[model samples]
Target: MSRLPPAIFLMGPTAAGKTDLAIELAQALPCELISVDSALVYRGMDIGTAKPPSALLEAFPHRLIDIRDPAQSYSAAEFVSDAREAMAEISASGRIPLLVGGTMLYYRALLDGLAEMPPADAQIRAALEAQAEAEGLAALHRQLAEVDPESAARIHPNDPQRLVRALEVYRVSGMSMSEHRARQRAQKAGAGESERSILPYTVAQLSIAPAQRQVLHHRIEQRFVQMVEQGFVEEVETLRERRDLNPEMPSMRAVGYRQVWSYLDGDYARDEMLQRGVAATRQLAKRQLTWLRGWDGIHWLETSARDNLPRALKYLESLSILS
Candidate 1:
């Protein structure tokens, strides 16, 4: 396949030093940083999301961040559209596009286009939201089991966001979520795969080695505490003012936002907020690692950030992708 410049993917778990690495790489590589983070898309979700500071963002070109209000809906399909636009502009400007962040599904959507699911139905959305509120997430799980047993089995009972989305898709399309998912899985992966495919661009996954789990966890905890010190509570309070956007909304339910919302709602003691935040971050990291382990076309750097860049550049050079 002909190269379309390197589209380096700097991905790792939460608080795993991904942003710092990406920032440093941007200074050396001919790349424009584009975020694949699901949470960073929302505006006013600053400290809790661990978003880059304004000054840092100004120092480097970044995209797909703070483009929507907290109440606005931003899905993977939307992310693909926006990310591609950013990529094109960056490429035209003679720069590589560095895709970064830990949102695995967003990265997947960027690499492999989303299936053409039906547009959402307001009525169906209302019904599913009501059912989720009244019957709770378990009932949604059972509903998923009835419609798409495979996806139901795959998704956790507590992953209310995905459960509701699956149900909504079925309700709007008059087809089971399983059917749509099956079709998506049936598609082949390769050159000229689809317009959404990022194969024309180079990609790699750099890791800090698996043995550093303890260190990673410690970093995650330290980051959350730092976020708290940096006014994470105030950030959530600002988002809380928008009551129309419930904690169940896609943007509101983002990891840090959700935890901070709980703090605002008085669900936890003041001290417990930091503890709960740290645990949620750890869970997010676990999920990120799980996703990376299953991804294809992603070569591991096999070293910590300090030693990973040169090795990663070497791998990119071998692949003829660091144009």
Candidate 2:
């Protein structure tokens, strides 16, 4: 059945109740959600990353969750390819593909192909991580700016994760991240000229802006505490038992992991650890919101009330998306 792959993408910031709302929509519509989250892909990572409970899965079908071990590497490019295949499979199964996640890059990768970024070099990454630990992330950002001014111009100094990656890329490839990016852009443009290879999904993005920053901050703090009570500490301890996994790995670098890691390393005091974890999560949410706002071709829904899903559904329907 060669049909237009009918699908929808629902995206929003963290702690926005997207999970339940997505399942609710499934009841009224014929759809199965594919996770677009980078964090939710890891197996045995439930509390901190907040993978949907088993009951939710029984209620509505989901793809791309628990697809990778915590120690393994998963990239946006791989996600794009796998998710494209998943979409085809879902369509073949006579199901609608409704994708959900807060990971902006994954969403973009699915909507428009990601440029081929070079693979990570372990030794180079270790060197960069060591430098960040010994000196500071600011110095690393400066180093990246010195080497890849173009990428540095776009990446904020506070974005230590991306800055370190850019530095590592330059270290391994002998090409500035800027040059690599330019080359990728050229290739992407060439691909665009031939035909649109972007995933053919009926993307519908929905979101609710927190009216008060303090409320969002409060939510972040509460969620961190809940995750802690929900065995996040134990989860990190299990990951710690992995002799190969480093704190620099993308999975390990998630908000709570780093803080609990510092605590386990006997570095941070109890109060400092909690504060840092909560603060990092807030910052992450802020960055996610920035990315969501900056994205083009995204349909946003700003709801003032708690039951925002209905309004979001109505918005999608208004956009000529059928139920």
Candidate 3:
């Protein structure tokens, strides 16, 4: 049998050294780097997003970074579309696509097909946002818990964007988002379709998970401190100055950016902000790992393992996607 063309998924929690591994793989393989990160898509979000430096990017270019303004919203659906096009382009040029990032949702949407849910209803979304403002996101999340406990449990109360979206999905379709997804899965399975092959490509997934969770937590804290030292606060301040941007915007809600925005708004002191930022990042990593755990056919590597690249190469070679 002919081996399917390969697409590499280098996924992990934040501060997992995915970027360096991706560059190393790109050098060793015929692959193009396509960022699977949502935050990296925003132009001015470099420092907080931990985007690769210009010199490094010049050496190993990553597609889909700096593609959006800070105020604009980029959804998982959009990421799937953009990634498919980039992957096709790369494959046509006889190069594999190495998608690298911590955005598990984007990775899932690209790999496992999403249900054909209704598109965003701006009027309904606006109304939901208004209601959230009046009643608070936690309150809205409570309402979601009543309707879609599965989604509510998965979504954080402080996550207004997801809260509003879940509520909007329910209000519009009279069915919870989780229910819709479940139904989609049932239908697909009944039809003898593989949910993981949503897109037309052979994928070799590589996940970098730290053996000790505390190791990841420590890395998260240290990375945030480094981000602060690298002008993360100034980056958020610049975005804060933009009239169109605000704390509620999805871009600003990014882990470090959100905490820094709160600090800038006098919501907390610098020390508290640093603490909250690190905590929020750790939470984000935990969430990413949860998603990673549920995924199938991934080659898991301990992030602290010294020979991760060799292990990943061996796994890919075993699959005949790399030789």
Q: Could you say which candidate leads in lDDT?
A: 3
lDDT of 3: 0.89
The local distance difference test score of model 2 is 0.77
**Model 2 per-residue lDDT tens digits across residues 26-64:** 886777789988888888778888788888777776899
Q: Which residue pairs of candidate 2 clash?
A: none
Model 2 lowest lDDT segment of ten:
193-202
Which 10 successive residues of model 3 have the least lDDT summed? 110-119
Q: Which residue runs of candidate 3 sit more than 4 Å off their true CA positions?
A: 1-3, 119-127
Give model 3 RMSD, 1 decimal: 1.7
TM-score of each: 0.87, 0.85, 0.95
Clashes of 2: 0
Residue 278's lDDT in candidate 2: 90
Q: What TM-score does structure 1 among the candidates reach? A: 0.87
Tens-place lDDT per residue, model 3, 212-244, is 999999999999999999899999888888899
lDDT of all predictions, in order shown?
0.77, 0.77, 0.89
